[model samples]
Target chain A: MAPKLGIVAGSGGLPAKLAEKCRETGRPYFVLAIEGEADPATVAGAPHAWVRLGAAGTGIKLLKEQGVVELIMAGALKRPSLASLRPDWRAAKLYAKVGLRALGDDGLLSAVIKELESEGFTLVGVDSVLTDAVATEGCYGRHRPDAQAEVDIAHGFRVVDALGVLDIGQSAVVQQGVVLGVEAIEGTDALMRRCGTLRREGPGGVLVKAKKPQQERRADLPTIGPQTVDLAHQAGLRGIAIEAGGSLVIDRDEVAARADRLGLFVIGCRKPS
Target chain B: MAPKLGIVAGSGGLPAKLAEKCRETGRPYFVLAIEGEADPATVAGAPHAWVRLGAAGTGIKLLKEQGVVELIMAGALKRPSLASLRPDWRAAKLYAKVGLRALGDDGLLSAVIKELESEGFTLVGVDSVLTDAVATEGCYGRHRPDAQAEVDIAHGFRVVDALGVLDIGQSAVVQQGVVLGVEAIEGTDALMRRCGTLRREGPGGVLVKAKKPQQERRADLPTIGPQTVDLAHQAGLRGIAIEAGGSLVIDRDEVAARADRLGLFVIGCRKPS
Candidate 1:
């Protein structure tokens, strides 16, 4: 008999990989994968149940029924369609506890964590199982930012860090010496689109993304992947820098290959001076 | 004939009023208004010239031709259009002279001011004309934020000020304890739309718009009014706070009346605790 862990899975391959890692480590895990967000293959080797993100409370109930002790949350939850999230009685109660006109990504996650902890389900970090996934410091790929792009990267990193410190946002767009855009709840993708729509040479800026300095662990972390790289290439961005070890690098090889082909510099950046 | 001052105008009626005050105080002023931003009437009384925002050289030339001794930059410039600004030789030269990539707003403006002074225009502050137009400390409307909203406002003010210090932005969208959006080049109106689109309910949230603590006084001063109030109502924001004396209050009658009708509190927010 192996130690049983509970997995709250979101969309993407990360959930599947996490489940595989648990099995390989001789830990039997019960996965509650979000419908549409999680890969269909997430539960093939693991005892798993399908759950919609809107029904997260129900997932917790299922995990509890499986006699799981520690819960590991992994992957990305599709942002809930506010109009469609039909909260069950348990979810409704959780909602009542979060009193506000709106909840930011961090606020909502913290509230959810509190609710789970109060219920006797111990929460664990998403990366606790896969430590090697965090990108190393310095440039990750073969291509590096050009002299001008490097300057923009430095500028973008500082602006993004400033936004993070204010707990407002953690992404910024910079070109030459001017900022093209800053990310808010609309996310990095939208910010790229706006920069493209607003500027003619569109993808000529640099995009920097990072986690807020004071963000609670075991919650939302900055993430990037092939799509992000593709979007940057499409938006005419010259380069991108993500904080080393603090962000999820999904399909790093594919992202790097895309960057190489597009002549865009994609690297794990350090703290800008 | 009165001594002429140069009124560098951007958006809204603040430029108009600044010009009116200069006239009332017996000074003939040359108004240099950004074509798409200024109220035509604000410059109608003065010897005014229209210049596109990115054309710093044209702005300088206009003031110089009018024999203007003192320059007063009032109102807000649309964040320079990254996609469409067509700069002349002077603006190109000015851009070259000020080449730091991540320089904050004050840094950029100081560069612009230094260039203008080098060319001999004396930049002045709006307080020299109508001191009453400067906001004072206190809640300006009928509704004071309830305890929760007050906490939100205080937190939001701190966040906005931190952002100001880094020159990332100056406004934030706060609801309860969460920040939904922070103003960048897109400005407050766009941030309001992002909040409204993301979380479509509640009596409304709090919007804190402040001037950067170390901003160049003669440059654009943050201003709010009826349109802002209307935007708040449409976006479901409960209130707004502008910095006292550090901002401009334009079209007060309409703004206050609209706010009262909408049950939205429009306050003159001070520096945070």
Candidate 2:
């Protein structure tokens, strides 16, 4: 009997990609799609069940019934307001244990992961199932960062890294040595849009993305895709830099081709440990 | 002979207010306004001359001819783009001495101050002229910060203090220990507007303003006015906290009245040394 894999899917195409990879590799898998977050079309014609964000107990029950032992969490779960959630018995118990300390996304996710592990489920990282989605180090487009852009990239990485340490954000726009913008609750796209407004008639800035130092890699890894390239270009940025092996580059070939077409460089940077 | 006061006026009513105070006190003063920056209406019918931003030598020459030895720099001077500035010999010399280190506004101002002092001008702080404008400690409205608002105020101060250490900006919006936004190149009003957009339906955030740790107090001091109270109300904020004796409260009575009317608190806090 094949070992069953269970995907606790959220929003975006990563969930579908993971499911497809499992099918192609002849692995039996089921998706527990989060309602209002995961697209139903992504898991169409597959063994899946829909559950609300706070229905951890029900999801575990369904997975156990399917004899699933391995679990993978993929895609984004937009932070919902506390008023909006109706947590089931398991989620309620979990929240009671974590208490107010679980206010941050990382804290809540960590608590959930601990509970799942205690329940005997082995969690796997999405990158392990979709290796090609992980960004490789170095430039991937026809246009590479010029000397000035290189300086901006380095500065942007420092700013983003500092921001990550504070757990405030993971992206920043930097030109020369001045930080033009920093992301907070507004998210990356909004930050890029702001950089667009602040752009002057000169060498543009660089958008740097990196994972938080204490981030749970298996649950949520920083990701970029074709839309990111477009947004960066629209923001008049020279390039994009992501932490190598720590960020997901969705539709890599398309992202590279778009970067080439837009004359923007996409590089993977490795911050020194 | 009484040494004449030189007013290096920038935009905003602060310059006008300072000039008026000097006039009322029977102190001789001359205003050297920056072209393309200061409002002509602010210095209307006053002893004033306009010099382009980069023509620092010409400005000093005018002040010397007026026998202005004591200089006061006031008002908001939006950092102009590099290409827009047309530096004269003196300005060029100052920039060469400062080199690329003058990228931030504080850096450029510091360099300018050094040059002025070297040339025998005694720079004075605006607070020396407008003593009543300085904010005093304690709450100044019908309402005071509740326990949660006090916590948010403390958190806001810490965030702004950290940002100041980085010399980024001097304003931050905080709610329940979470920083909603921090001002960068976007300025405080924009940060407030962003907080307005990010505000949740609850006991809103607090706007904290403070002087940078290394800030040259004689040149730039954080300021809040009646408009700030209106904006805070519009943003659904519970209160505004400013460093006591380190910030200017323009239209103080009106600001307090407005805050009281809007059920918001205007507090002057003293961050311990």
Candidate 3:
């Protein structure tokens, strides 16, 4: 029998969708919803507990009490700061240990994953549960990338690779052979919207996303959904290119249909090793 | 006597400042003020001709007519587009030849430099005329980068170096070991303002500027002025770091004085070759 799962929900509908998947499969799941970040509806009908991000000690205790041996962290959360998080004793110790020693968010996440494993919980990636979430190499919709867009996608990847080498960002926008913007702490969503206004008159931009070179796969794989298609179209973009097998496509069919409806190409390129 | 300098002025005070230097030094010069971008004050009392950016043919004609033998391009200009520029016959020819093949703005600039040389004209960097414009290695003000700021500045350079590898941009903002933002089509001022809101708690960010790896130094060297110090301060940044010997710091005294007054460190770093 599969061990009962702990959904460490943060924000977005992915957690809810994961819960629904577990319910359909008759797999018992308990949600440890992060206070403030996790959408409330994620725990509406689930056996769960709300815990402040800073109070990981209590969260761990609750998960153990609920008999959750398998864990999956979902959705997005801000990079925690001492002032913003007000870490409890356990969290404080972790923060002090990892936060100072790490150079980037991925380092801190790796530390967290190690801590969770040492606590006897085996952490799983979201894609393991939502099998269809993993993106593969191919054009997903009716629209295909033109020669110019193909070049731009290549350019975008080079830029993303450079950013990742610094452990900086996973996405970049390229239009007419010019890098329009890069995702930093602002995120892919804002990066797309900002690049929208910066586009030149020629071929529209391409939104390219990939995992950082040193990113912790179990913690954060780059992700896009139908909403990403909408944002791309709104940003006057011509296509979307994500690292194949290194990124997630939430609701793939919906994303392809949306991209088709918006006259945009959605292709997955193999990320260089 | 100084080879009859031709100032191909773009937008901003740099062109005007360069013109003033020529006037003060009693060097014969002519200003080829671009139609839409060059500030009027730049040529208010100088030997100048207003020419559409698309009318490069006419500008070249006027430069020869004025006996202009040496040229210097100064200040900032948007990356031109066919729709926005409405290229003239000669400009159209040049654009058609260079636009499609170049991967980025620097490539286009390099081609333009080659074209000017083919036409028997010499091009010079901004630092040549404005002797004090060249930034050299050192902390320029009362404040020095603290240990944390020093680390962030080093981190910022890694980000900038990665950006340069792709010919992306000249600047990036990093705070507490995290990249806050990078400049692309949005320019440096906007990059700083955008980064201000994205900064993490603890130490403020540092603005780092460097030339692209294959940049056309004579055409578009990385530059900063007193206004940059103001922007850095307003962005809640602790300091400014620019590539020493590879970037220009206009009005060095003013930049230093302003940085001192604002309690910000303005350092020139030795760029890695």
**How many residue pairs clash in all the candidates, one count each?**
7, 0, 0
DockQ by candidate, in order: 0.28, 0.36, 0.58
Estimate the TM-score for candidate 2: 0.89
Chain A TM-scores of each predicted structure, in the order given, are 0.83, 0.93, 0.96
Q: Is candidate 1 or 2 superior in DockQ?
A: 2
Candidate 3 residue lDDT tens string, B1-273: 678999999877889889999989999999999888899988998999999877878988999999989999997767765667778798888878886522677877787778787888999888889878889999897889988788888888877877887878889997777778888878899999898787766778899998887788887788888999999999899999999988989888899999999999999999765
Model 3 pairs in collision: none
Candidate 2 lDDT, B1-273, residue by residue in tens? 347899999877789888888888888999999887788987898999999988888999999999998998998676655456667888888878886422666777787888899999999889988999999999887789998788878877776776676666788887655567777778788888988988654578899999988889988789888988999889888899999999999888899999989999999999889
Most accurate candidate by lDDT: 3
State how far residue A12 of model 2 sits from its true place (Å).
4.6
lDDT of 2 at B81: 50
- In candidate 2, clashing pairs total 0
Which docking class does model 3 fall in?
medium
Task: Give candidate 2's error at residue A222 in angstroms.
Answer: 2.2
